[model samples]
Target: MKKRTVADRGADGSERPRHCADGMPNTTMEVHVMHKSIRTPHADTRRRAAGGELIGSQEANGTHAWRGIRYAQAPTGPLRWRAPQPASAWDGVFHALAHGPMAPQYAGLLAPVPAKLYGRIVGDEDCLSLNIFAPAWASDAVPAGVQRRPVMVWIHGGGNAVGTAASYDAARNYAAHDGMVVVTVNYRLGVLGWFRHPALHEADSGTAEERSGNFGTLDLIAALRWVRDNIAAFGGDPGCVTIFGESAGGQNVLTLLASPLAAGLFQRAIAQSPVAETFSVHEATERNDLPLESQRTSAREVVARLWTAAGKAPDVDAADQALHATPATDLATWLRSLKPEELLSVFKPGSVGICLSPRPVRDGVVLPLDPLPEVFRHGAWNRVPVIIGSNRDEYRTFLADKPEHVRLLFGKLPLLRDRAEYITESNFYSQAWRSLHVEEPADAMLAGGHADVWTYRFDWDEAPAVPFVRPDILLGAAHGMEMAFAFRDTAGELDIFGINTSSNRAGRRAVAQAMGDAWTSFARVGVPRLSGDAQWQRRTHGMAAETLLIDSPAGGGLRMAGVRQDIASLKASLRLSPQVSSGESRCRIYARVFLWSPLFAGLGSEQEYAELGREFGCAQPASVFRQLTEV
Candidate 1:
């Protein structure tokens, strides 16, 4: 190792010991410089792991963090769609200072790029890695009768298409103050992570996991296995692991719960703003001849696009014929040889930054054939303690981008056109999200005889007032708003909307403390406990089901109520609300809520929309609104 002397200059230009080459302060120089001031020196941040020796960095918060620790081999060359393999042991010390590359994806808000490279692919195919953060004393010798710290593994959310482990700073708060080991992981995204085709399966020699096309799911499972085998070196209890995430990460949390292969990998789980939806084998592979942009995610459609782009076929018909005539081995080789950017260019991203790709597939191997709800209802899932929730205004953040509701000024600031209509529509869709993500899943787990389920609704919507821009109206308790509080992220890691302000800092800090306490408490034990009299209760059956409301003190604070919603009740309330002006407006809201939302997308059809309109005194057919919205 290269040796260097580093010091801090005092106000008088005198040298002060700050860091040494061995990762410890120069105690002799410090004692002579300041005779009265002294402190215990921190241990060197070097540790041994199964893979090799790792050297991490110490943070300002007195925590040790290791980034870009390879848990699995890079999925490149012929291993593109195969299950992840464990990383081979190395010979020398690995300096884990920076994060590994994210999965290949288009540059967006989650993974931003330079202005010149906007909308371009900006990641790598060799992206399977994990990060770890622990307290400074984690590597020290444990005293007698003391137990290891609980582990919390984080999975980032980017529609399961775009995100990186480096985007978050886990050691700043969660690990430094909460006395727990935190882990952030990166898995394959978009088509590379979850593609299903017969040719690729033939290349892999017919392995069940490879044929399932759930490579991302398998990547997460491999990470958990690595934690179980190696987390003890970081002073973590592998048996007390908790899997948590928001948005698509939350969706993956639910997927792991229902996966038989993920059994015993974790003892607790927290899913925030999660959508419980999965694609079937047919939806993942079969060609959908629909004109909508979403139908192009299927493997058959992707192959046709690649074929035409590669000049191997003239049109769709010729592409289909060539695909049929090509040998399975040749097709697999051609797919492996294509550049990552070329494969990513075939699919377009939605306004919300999510690519049109199938999520977790129900392939009957890694995941069950039945839907997640059915699997939980039948007690076929890994029954662990769970906390599930959604935001109150889940759809406002999404709807703010729609041209009809809000118009952008200077291509940045937002101006709401109709506050009443925007709020009404946001309510309908947000309630639907809550019902599907929280209520139904909680009810299913209860039915499966697992009563250790807690639920919450994030309702903190106190954005400071700004002229011309109404963040309070545009982003009121919207999706992913609770993550900053959940992780105690005072540095604004998850605050992409710039909702934080000086006026709300105190309230935000209070809420963050309460939430961080509750989460750490849950990881320590199975139940969640707060500091004050606000005791979070479990979900019960029947009409008396209760949900904890998480909010700031200025916004009614944290409380519990017996509030529940379902599709039937939501439609009924929409029909009665005075804000719904006309049949056309009501149909527009219905189209967005039922057809575009991930929870009900594939299940809802035009026939159901028309039937709903007729039953509620609206004479407009569903096609009229569908054509207008192009949904």
Candidate 2:
């Protein structure tokens, strides 16, 4: 099988870990407690919302914070792999302070997300919770006919396998400063988030939704439902909500955009660096390797491999056998009984150091057949306004350690920031790799409706990137770097999510100001402003694409250039070129072939010099090209 080049990080190459550790018995009861502190608010008796009473905390800044409030029933014990159930209302005041435990971490579970490249997150199964950041005046009680500020629900990125709502705090910046209600969420991770089994069908109540393998996605939907029902008290307008996220979280937002289950949950969305990969149930589940094996793909078979490697967690290992040999009844029982840690080591990285276990399944019931095809093919449930974009350099760090051929295309050796050495990724340059990301969807959304979509390329490259140590390799705005600017407040300057930036960049603060205004503005109204001065044009297809190239120079001053190029038409032309009859005129071939050619990215300004008629040694079988086109 051919290897895939880009995803959210290779797990961003979407969102893994696998395998037993020596000596320790990794199991359920023995599950480790996450240590990240989720602060409970100082006691506030007067104001409380539905879901019983929530004890709130008052920040020094006068912002009200409510952390670690459950939004769904725990997916533990018999509830494992089931669709999330609404959180049972609590009796006493639910202490809204400390963050709840995040979903367990494993190769199957990913964390530090795309933007969160550093930080230790403690994992737990009881992790479906949300934190609320509301202004002092925004109480849960709102008079009928009165309206509150718009709401923004944040989803954190970790390759899809691992990340926690506790990983970020948007209260001080987004809510307190912007005067909007902010909600950060914690969803299931790794296998707990996405998994499917044929035998699992009999376990459900026969409801299509019950047997779904999209728990993480369901968790997000549930949070939105909670926001819609209860946000007014928090001083938020439930009818006007925007969902935004970076990396895997961004991909989730995109998923919500295409999901029938998520229709009407939010009126607007912003997806930053969304991983463009999706999986089918069989593709997600099927694998054959190791001590206990099935010839083909099966959830039980996948689990049995974990059992054999980890020596059981004792539940399923206690069973007679795995694979086809295990009875359906026994399999279901074994599945429910398997410990969290027991399942932890079942996944590991391949020879090239990429973990492959965590991904959402496209079960026709909950998730559509394919997100890209469905939304691009006019299959969206809510035609909401979308702000979608990618950074100028998305996959540099991932390429830092890959083979030479891989590096040649995606890498900028040491310091050479601009002018990438060669087009290594079949095309060349990491930014070029991301062009398809924003291009495909933005064009589709525009074709669907005007002003319904906006696309951008994040170009802020001033920060440290280690930055003092190695600015050269960091190149132009790398993946997940724009997040701090987008979610932060201007006063503090420093951000909670640790990304490297310094005052040295002349107008760094200006960059943050631009992003903050854009994000908060979009949340308040449908339209977003990249900078105070620049006008953001809606992206459209065939028509010259007006992409807002957001960049701030060394001295300062937000440079928002509305570059015009018909990326949609260019991509469309590339898709059509291979079909033209052979022996065609050079002008026709020159027009399409060279642009998409593996050499295009490396060509730089020499595009006019490149000749398509010349025989190039590097060419895939014609059938492969056609197959890829079909896909």
Candidate 3:
């Protein structure tokens, strides 16, 4: 095998070295397209003439690129809540010049703001799209043995509400420098994608699949299916695909790993700050306003009272019926009204009593079983390799947004500016402890196969860009900060999730260099290497798991300095009495239900069911039985 640079062409035909009349090099380049058009069934799409590139294939100059490709169709209008269907082929060449739109944004989740104001576009309905960057010259002519490359698919994170694949540009940075292909994908977000109603099943009763309501999630499945079927055309090994994402995206990745629908679509997976827990079907029905025995009851009630003045339960299938006629705008307003309360309703409700509690639902058709339970009981995609970890200050970001909420809890505010103090003042000490429980799912997934599990914490925080005290208040590498370095867009301004150090060129380069190498190496093979030459250690059982910490000093290998036993204790206490509050109840139920279902199935442990009982405020045996049977 011959070593290649980003610009070099090997067996793949090379483009002619051309210059303008004035002999100036071209700043813009054309990306190649792979067609599944019936007219060109076995078509060859070499971009030698225009520099079209395929994903995951190595090229000369060590640069690789894959332009626009279809992962899933936009699920708008009649398609809303429907499973994604394969996209149709085109006749003339289609240019994947820019990213497609993001999912519809509501008040919470992925609500996109102005790019100028926030550096990100708000969510839209037409967000289904795909983009890839690979070695610039990877071509069909590249021999088969030399073309064996690992593939990485990225799912953007925005709390499962906001964010798009278009938010980041991996083409110029990670793909070019790492010598591997990178793919970014978009999926449905917020109510437009996740809303559920019982009418879905009866309206389309011929198909049992019509009942489940995880549209955004199924969009991911469609994307993976596209990669499995079409990635090979771009010199990618369909068998070597890896799915990775952050936050909600991370949650989605793990959900797919556990979902049977996603089995065998990819060989490895990574989830950052994963939302490992989801609502049981019963919980979803309750939150979505469905009656304990019927979704139609609640949906009809809302439609009749809210949408129709007559307040009548018209036929469910009637297009103008109250149940089906509720507008998307109205739905978004309803969801937004519930946003602020989510913090209290779901995770860490402090003073507030009740809050909005919309979460992922475990419908038997889509989710099958709860992810945590599935993982704990050795029930997910057992054969794939995985890398799972969380940011150092995952929850503090939430704190930064609501200082008053903290003041409401702790009485007087603590004057803390240093990263350490902030972590303490923000109640991070308690939060981080409970968070360690997240490792159960990853551990179970790795235990069943030849899996390499790597964990990490990002500690770097750039100097504050604006006029704010604690210029570097230092959330200590808060959630999603690592994304800037990973995608190598530290210099480029983005719509939202802006560049961390927008002005510092050298620091961005170094971090980007390190991150790109690590990610691409993992995609190429199974292990991730931090730098071009540095060897990353594979994680093993019964050892202090080595984590590559991205901090002021760019280095790998760091462990949590503080003890996590406090969190364990807190978790245990919460399990015994989850109904103390909504946040406590939600977190405790999520942890126990997810923990037992995945790794210790049929354990019938008292702690697990006891936690569930507490979540529903089941004061008596009859109430507990009622809740379980109703679900």
User: What is candidate 1's lDDT per residue for 442-548, written digit by digit as tens?
Assistant: 88889988777899999989887787688888899988788888987655556777888888888888888789888887877667889788889888886463888
lDDT, ranked from best to worst: 1, 2, 3
lDDT of each: 0.78, 0.60, 0.50
Residues 1-631 of candidate 2 have per-residue lDDT tens digits of 1111111222433111111011111112211122345455564422556678776776555667778888888989878888788888878767777778878764222343342322322378899989887665534343222346667899987666666777566434665567677899999876778777766666454458656677788889988988888876666666677899987898888888877888777878999987655667666665544311112224655676666665644554443254456666677777788777667556543211223455666777777776564455576556667898887666544443334323332332443222232122212234344555566666667666534577777776664555323443444466667776786534333333234445544455667767878877777656786645577777755545466666665523444344433334444343344433342222333332333232122222123323332333223322222111100
TM-score to true structure, per model:
0.90, 0.74, 0.66
Between prediction 1 and prediction 3, which has the larger lDDT?
Answer: 1
The CA lDDT at 576 in model 2 is 49
**Predicted model with the maximum lDDT:** 1
lDDT computed for candidate 2: 0.60
User: lDDT per residue, candidate 3, 449-552, as tens digits?
Assistant: 43356765566556444433343453445666677666655445331333355454566567666665666556555566674444555555454634556554
Which sections of candidate 1 miss by over 4 Å? 1-43, 112-116, 142-146, 290-292, 543-545, 596-598, 611-631
Q: Is candidate 1 or candidate 2 better by lDDT?
A: 1
Per-candidate Cα RMSD to the true structure, in Å, reads 10.2, 13.0, 11.8
Q: Which ten residues in a row have the lowest lDDT in candidate 2?
A: 16-25
Going through the candidates in the order shown, the clash numbers are 0, 40, 47
